[model samples]
Target: MTLRGTVRTSYEVLTSRFGPPTFPQVDDGGLPAEDSTLWLIDTPAGRVHVHNWLDVTYFLKRPAAETRWSIQATDDAALPWIYKSVTGSTAAFSAGVHEFSRYSTRVSLARGYVTYLVQRMIALRERGERYDQGSREHRHQIELSRHVGHMALQVQQIVHDVEWAYADDADRRRWTTLPMPQLADEPESQHWHRWTRWTYRPVPTDSRPEGGDPDLVGMLRRRARDQVRFRDRILPANHRGPTREGKVELYDEHIGTLLTLADTALPDTVEQSRS
Candidate 1:
């Protein structure tokens, strides 16, 4: 139950259930420095737990009975936006929280994986610059870059799918659009006059904002509607369909802005909550 080893530890854990999760060659920056992790996490019933290097204490925390585990790098930082969106998600979940745990957890894990891989690739790229031809280190550099490229593609795909799902027309109408929000920098007295609209919007309902520009609201809603219709055609009944990862990779390679939308789509509960 409590198994610990090198990188192989995590590999064994994933293989036990999924029968060997295939990793596309990923290159983001550097080779892992022996301290990375692989984890088989078990959360307590009715409670959600996340594994990271932070020091927040919660009551009644228990060590997971590890079936299989691997260690991977966590020292590398993620893009600020990733942290922002992920925090928003967990906060949203904890507040009105529904337990659409599976999809929600998958999205979080995928984002973490992508962020880690990108950091690793950047590290590798830095190391490769000092290589001597025909040296083992040089060869390793080439291999790492290959992996980074693959990982980058994979990250792109995840973003595309989520954005497609959120931006869809149906989703847009559901989440109600917010065309403008108040600025903290605006003086309390001047706040009413300082409203500027954001083209970015969500569908379903516009309950979040105090008020928004009428024109921007309409435009955002229409755009959200159009995108939802476009994406609905693409989502497979099983989100983890055989080609799910592959389809995401294809989108990452060809389309840009993959990162922007990946973090913003619905939390796991949206679909079920809506119904």
Candidate 2:
């Protein structure tokens, strides 16, 4: 299929399932000659972003069917809805990569969902003390804990996928040699060198820094571990304690640490690659 054909087919499938998009598609200017298109569709599940782009390298050699396309959720809550709608299964809060295909279009759709679940886990942890034992909120938290545990494993799968995709002998050695990050350890270092070290230290056994962008790899690893901690330790422990007012503080600290590590390691611009 040509790039335009793939996009048209994708749009048709989406419209059939979710109705027409809220707005017209827009052309996002791209490198000299290639065309790029962006579509935004609002569904009960949340806003979905559909982007299609022509490869720029040896630009003329690739076929239109080869054009890359991505479908992503704009927010966390929309994920469950999308998952159910796409899979036709009861929305299990369980995590892992979810792929849906129609008319040759495939989407990897679990990362955002897991991220949103983590957010929920954090909120429940902060407010656990407000609910009486065996009450609705307490029961909900318990159920969510199980979901979060499954989600953590899903995140681990993603991390493992990345690690395998990019692993090399040197990368393996780096991980085996470095110390893993502890749950209490705050990723405070702003220098790329330090940030990279800290992010890899915690999962030295599974981490591979040589495969793709180091920063992106590190972020994924750190976030994966953070989710695991929230599911296994932080939330459970907090639920057992008296209601606390410091949830927001703790949440901010966690977000700040991730942001700092990201800022330190990510480059200002990413160059598009041709497949």
- Most accurate candidate by TM-score: 2
Residue-level lDDT of model 1, residues 47-106, one tens digit each, is 111222311121113222232222222211122222222232211221111122323332
Steric clash pairs (candidate 2)? 45-78, 179-201, 180-201, 180-202, 181-202
User: What's the lDDT for all of these models?
Assistant: 0.35, 0.41
Q: Candidate 1 at residue 187, lDDT?
A: 38
| TM-scores of the models, in the order given | 0.29, 0.33
Candidate 2 weakest ten by summed lDDT: 100-109
Candidate 2 lDDT, 1-275, residue by residue in tens: 11111122343444456564433333466333435444565644456665556322322343223333455553334544443443332133223111222211111123433444454455564565478886767765655555544553444354444443446678767765766554554322113223334454233333533343334445544774675466455555545432222333333333443333233322222121111
Alpha-carbon lDDT of model 1: 0.35
Off by over 4 Å in 1: 1-104, 169-275
Which lDDT value does model 2 have at 23? 34
**Candidate 2: C-alpha lDDT:** 0.41
Cα displacement (angstroms), candidate 2, residue 267, comes to 28
